[model samples]
Target: MPNRRAALLALAAPMLALHLPLHAADAEQAPAQLTTVPGPFRADAGSLKTYQAPAWFRDAKFGIWSHWGPQSVPRAGDWYARNMYVYGSDQYKHHLAKYGHPSKFGYKDIIPLWKAEKFDPEALMALYKKAGARYFVSMGVHHDNFDLWDSRYHEWNAVKMGPRRDIVGDWRKAALKAGLRFGVSEHLGASYGWFATSHGYDQIWPMLGVAYDGADPKYESLYHRPHNQPYRNSASWYTTDKRFQQEWFNRITDLVTRYQPDLLYTDGGIPFGAVGRTLIANFYNASIANHGGKLEAVYDHKDIGSGEFIREAGVQDVERGVMEGINPLPWQTDTSIGDWFYSEGYKYKTTTEVVHMLADIVSKNGNLLLNVVQYPDGSLPPEPQQFLKEMAAWMDVNSDAIYGTRPWKIFGEGPTKAAAGHFQENTAYTAQDIRFTTKDGALYAITLGTPTGAVRIQSLGRKAGLEPRPVKAVTLLGSATPLRWEQGDDALTIQLPATLPSAISSSFRISF
Candidate 1:
């Protein structure tokens, strides 16, 4: 498991790191937890290494995610529940000015405010399908511990609260109707450690020592059980409480058993050691049973960090980042357009940036799970809708290059280098940046940005030795005209047309 204490610290919520055990990644730290489900794989790494990603997930290079929930009710971006109780943080100020203090109006109060009146899964799924999304993931649960489905274990779910809709079921139906795969993300593992903030008290003169709404016994299920562990600023982010680990296992197992999602994404590394592993084993067994003895499910997690990159356990998920090079096994990169949740003043990623990231990720043998930010009502703001439309227009020409493609001999020839690993998402690429992907017997060279004139692909050059085969023909993806090209020992130069099909980026098909 990759240590994610840095992620929490990066969020400006370091106090949440308190009460976290130092041995979070220790398998022996957890009791010998086991699931009743039958399967060939064990909860240990050696047995689970035989797991392989299904063909559906690999062929589907792009997926869309709805990271929406009650947190969006404040329209205050990511981590509203935790930050709102941090005294003077941005979300805290927003919460105080808008809905009084944490003592009165807590995250529980924000639940009913999330009336997804305009939420339409069918229509949105259709739009995503049109935008070239081959798979869709809905938020099954977040660190808020609020389930966004018709949950069997927990009572605080979408079926009974908020919109009173079966969010996950509706999404699965809609995705299947649109001929797209369905998946769900679970952030419940770290909730035990994260939601402890709700138990804080105000230090100000008026509200000094006043218990927040979370400390009340009535809302224990929502805010979590009352814990008095001192906040230790350190690397641990997962709680050591065995009880919470059991709860996490039960809730997550219940979610997987019910929905049977094609994919399951955990926010951080596999949590609670043996507890998490057994849950995964059950998930895999269930997938096999559902798919006629074939494991057709993908379990995604960010277990890649430092010098460790384990491909055997499950698909390695890079959050807002990409692999340094082409990986041997299938993986994914989950990112968002603006904030994880919608914010009024936040600057969203442009269509070109999204396209570039998708291209880069696909070239490196990974899929991009993009989160389309939505409002509390489940209606998309104009920005995200426009982003999807623009992406669809771009995919009109470049879809073949992206989907069902594998990494070539080399990822690409580019001067703009993307910082590898987690949280290093921002990368500025020029027209010279070309990423490579292979399908059938052809090679695809995608420009990260719009090129002005002729472009040179150094990797395709004869002397480069990356592509030693002779080139038979060259053609642009959207253009009908054959490209005027010349190959040299140094680089393969292709003359650009006066007008291109799409303004976002371009893909050139090379047949050798």
Candidate 2:
């Protein structure tokens, strides 16, 4: 497998070079109301304020985000950058067939085609709630340079162009009415430079003179046409651009004031300037003001000093992966079953895969914010919808082992192991892998895979030479009758029922 950092840098390289200049005037200019600090990080105080992340968020183990935007119109996998490069790539082929050539249509034109036709917010919310999602996060803006909200700062917004409605407002209303915390993700920061690939063309193609229309005068804002740095064919082309950096600032500020979401997530670290600092401060202050300064806010930003800004004021989130080891503050890994958006050929994760991933993440002291991709018309694909139903069915009966629980003496006895970081390949866990969580002094042991009949746990009351706590009772979650158990010096054995509630996995709660 390719090194994870190299893959991450591949994602970050285009944006960093395009948006950060060695010397730029606007980088020094402080927004009127925003705080001013230099560099990419926000400073951390010695002691963080006493702030509790909202109760609803803590209880909400699952959420769904509409990562869709103009990008989904291509019906391709995520990352329009690399996909648009390979001529044979599904996205590239889709771009060519649906919209003429990559040159004429470019990505900019697709922005208008995202009609969001079947976008019935209330109906979608109902389905999400039914699927066991406790919160909803709508895409406020993606790296495609389009805002889903009614932006006062930019004309490239859903209300003015494509959907012709305040997408964020509709979703917020629906989520709040359903008693779900509303959040907005900001991929706008990286948009400044990430989309610079709009200027390049495939080296070998079906036809010649097929460069994308990044420099077209009429569509400058949509493509982020930077004035000082001319588009070049060099690999370092976007990294040296200056104008894109300034535009990045303007777009993010507009998003902050317009949405005021309960959660604000940046695609990467904030910009490398005082403006970035101000953006962070404003995000916190806005959350404080929105909740009358009582409820703590959440900002899912990256590269902010470790335990610095997050430990002090906000929460941290990982995209498509999780942290290497356990973390002090609560963190989340955002991923989906298949593509980030709905694609006809996309394969959703199996119920077993999803359940085990959740259990593993919780065991390591993290949360899983899963995204179930919905079709452009706002309907979930049958496969994902079915997967959600199965997951909900499992969660319904075994939720006691998950929600409102903390890691126990050890996070289970298991032979199963998951990768430690982002974009790592997922490996299957065997029945031997067990994850543990505790609540009210009761230990909940979850097996990654279902056992045939009886199960033995070697982690507790034996391996460590601790006092052998006799198994007073062992109950398989979601089953009608409590399973019988007997304890020996080395392990505790429990009888499994003839039938199981779920084929994916099972859990047991052992009370002292």
Candidate 3:
């Protein structure tokens, strides 16, 4: 099998090589040069192999993301644009009932409905900082092909249409004001084919013969022209069309050039082969130019574990999933409170679930980028606001264990094994489950749930085979006095106080 795989890769070498250096030559000749030489990244895996995640990204463990956009306008949750085109789908029915048929009132009509009148970046940024977010990410563009930022290339943008505001710029200003790193997420790569559904017609309808608005050539730029294949095909995620690829390159390049965000997140794996590589290279090169030769920018994309190109170029981002153990390199998990976009009646993850997930991910050398859903009017409902408040109160007492910490020898001690991969169910941790993180020679043992009378950590036992270090001092994070503890060969038992410090997870700082 290994020999066969190697033979296939060898046969594909020429095809892969065709994608290299597409923009490297042009970037080298640009008049306003960002770097003396060509950009730091290249389209091939060889050049990107030198990339490493920066220290700032590794330290800024927790980040808040606003996945807000016109898709939330209908309050029907994620994939509203595409799903609304899918015949017999819930969104399709909702669109038909709410406004009209796709032939008349489509996603284009929904764009103007996003007023964002209640959206106050300054106020939201303050809440995020208080909730312990070290970084903020704003939606630059989703699969709908609408730019949330002020776009110079495309006319379908936030400034000209929805909200009449540069959403990315406002979020960036707010994040910087709150001393938080800012990032942007671009889902445009898959959008070309993803939005192909817009060009489709209802198979069984009174208007069956009539085509959707996407078929109109006047709006072809906004609703992308139909591709050869059906929607949601794996290969179609990043379309094979050269015209679309070039457009993707131009728009993303404009985004990086205009914003110079601290981080850039691609919704899928590095896309469009050579064009994608050029985008990453230009991003890094521009970042270095902005930071006086020190690249502070970080790029994140999905890693399927088979692609060396993704593993080498940027931080691996798992969508609604987790790594099984401590990854040799830093990575991230981008999940949301409820639906990716706002849904009228969606249930959100509780604060306890979020905190426990954070601790578990951090213990495995991972960061969490959580999306707090917002309404179409740009306001969070009572439930999400309460969620943020709870997070703030918890962070007030236990943030020392979360920020600027590294994984310990072992991630945790627990019986409930967390299922690994995207879309897996969240683990329900018991009081016995414990996660570990460390900083400045101190170990922090975070109990997933508050224990009653006594807490025992088997990982710290003398005979646990980890060659465990002797505990010299142990103190509860929010408590003033030290706790009484005894170490045995089998387990380390600590007598807990009748009352706990925080209502959520409890942390014990251990010094050797």
lDDT of 3 by residue, 1-512 (tens): 00111232232233223312233232233222122225666656787767887888888899999999999999999888877776667788999999999999989999999999999999999999999999999999998999998898899999998799999999999999999999999988878756766776776658864777887888999987644533333433565666777778778888878888989998877886767876788788778778888878888988532112368688888888888989989999989999989998899999999999999999999999999999999999887899899999998989889899999988999777898866664889888999999999999999998788889999888989664568898899889866889988988898998788886789999888
Residue 226 lDDT, candidate 3, scale 0-100: 48
In candidate 3, which residue pairs get closer than 3 Å at backbone N, Cα or C atoms, i.e. clash? none
Which candidate, 1 or 3, has the higher TM-score?
1
Tens-digit lDDT track for model 2 on 1-512?
01112343443344334542344653445333444323323333321233446655655667777787777776776766334533455566777777776667777677777888988889878777876677788888776778888887788889998879998889999998998778888766555445655554554546633556664667778766543332222222223333454565566667666666777766555444445555666666566666665554566655432112334445666666656555656677778887876676877788888888777767656677777787765667788778878877888878888876766656666665566655653778888788887778788888888788788887654555543465577788888776777776667787888898777888888887
lDDT of 1: 0.84
What is the Å distance of residue 171 in model 2 from its true position? 1.1
By summed lDDT, which 10 consecutive residues of candidate 1 come out lowest? Answer: 228-237
Q: Where is model 3 more than 4 Å wrong at Cα?
A: 1-37, 304-309
Model 2 Cα displacement at 68 (Å)? 1.0
TM-score, model 1 to reference? 0.93
TM-score of each: 0.93, 0.85, 0.91
lDDT of each: 0.84, 0.66, 0.82
Off by over 4 Å in 1: 1-33, 229-234, 304-310
For model 1, how does the per-residue alpha-carbon lDDT over 1-512 read when each residue is reduced to its tens digit? 23333344344344334422344343334564556679897877887788999999999999999999999999988888877877667788899999999899899999999999999999999899999999999999998889988888899998999899998898888999999988999888667656777877654678866778887889999888765432223234466677778788888888888888999998777776777778888899889999999999899987642212346889999888899999999999999999998898999999999999999999999999999999899999999999999999999899989989999988987888899987778998889999999999999999998997898998888999887688888889889977899999888999999899988889999999
User: What lDDT score goes with residue 216 in model 2?
Assistant: 61
Using TM-score, rank the candidates from best to worst.
1, 3, 2
Error of 2 at 92 (Å): 2.9
Better of 2 and 3 by TM-score: 3
